[model samples]
Target: MDNPYKVLGVNENASQDEIKRAYRELVKKYHPDKYVNNPLKNLAEEKMREINEAYDYLTKNSQNSTYSNSGSSYANNNSSADYYSIRNDLNRGDVSSAERKLNSINSQDAEWFFLMGNVYARKGWYDNALNYIQKACNMNPGNREYMAALQNLQMMNNSYRRPYNMRGYSDRDSSFCDLCVSLWCADTLCNCMGGGC
Candidate 1:
């Protein structure tokens, strides 16, 4: 992987501009946001870690080093036994074993379904990824993790958009809030005037 640092295109003495550019480009290419319902977050995290390492390496050599990016800082530890098992299998490159482990579990919580969906996304089966993430979202409607995964799958088509343009529209995407974009203001007005409940 070409000096994980070099692959991210940063140097041991790169400027803040260069580091930010490299990180942004790589993050855009492998953003968890792009793969929300994706099974490939493990890969994305790998990329993130590489980018972070490259950034850290560069910053340390420079005069402006600040804000260390560490693994524990992400805090995505909402894991379970099955999730951990799946993670191990994935790290070991045993996708089938992970899938089998997932199937062996009886209780399907949001984390379980989300990780399953992530596995599917890694396999390039976006449809199944979508299905699993949706199930996860259903199990935990308020869970940010599940919701973020489900939304990520939905954003696949627009995943390449620049960060400034990347957005998650809940009212438009959520079934309960599927209000027409054009009539949003009018709808609000009507509801305020006691016209439509």
Candidate 2:
């Protein structure tokens, strides 16, 4: 609503590529998925909406210097609005409501898959979540939000154990080694006491 460049944190003279990069970063930062279960989810949603609007305005009026005079609105479709509502529901931990709304949608777009992934993730179904999020990333390769979600899921899946080489010893193995050392020490002590040293 104000300066588009300011909204995106870019200068007026910034190149188109720079503007796009900034927009992508902001989108990633304030994505609904990142704000899930956070108290600041509403604020993040508002920020994301503003970022989307600014990006749309800049791209549409790139040729014209008088960007402020352009009265063009963001190209928000009904499905997109619905997706935003679903994201709000998901953020509030209402997976069932979000799932119901998502399933009612006629078009299974990238956003749909992304939202479905969020629902699955909340339900502790990581495998299904990863599958759905991967599909979303595949469908919208350039979408930073979808790509980030997929990366996060993959990282979570691999976070439990250290690599084979890095794993020096497990707790069970260490305990066994400790027991062996104690028994050997006791044997040596007993021999010394019996004058066998």
Q: Top model by TM-score, which number? A: 2
For model 2, how does the per-residue alpha-carbon lDDT over 28-106 read when each residue is reduced to its tens digit? Answer: 8899889899999999999998899778756754442232312211122445457656876886798999999989988
Can you give the lDDT of residue 123 in candidate 1?
Answer: 91
Assess each prediction's global lDDT (C-alpha) against the native: 0.63, 0.76
Which parts of model 1 have CA positions greater than 4 angstroms off?
1-79, 91-93, 157-197
How high is each candidate's TM-score?
0.38, 0.50
Residue-by-residue lDDT tens digits, candidate 1, 81-148: 24555766776678888888788876565656777888898898888889988887775575665677
Runs with alpha carbons beyond 4 Å of true place in candidate 2: 1-76, 160-197
* Most accurate candidate by lDDT: 2
Model 1 vs. true fold: TM: 0.38
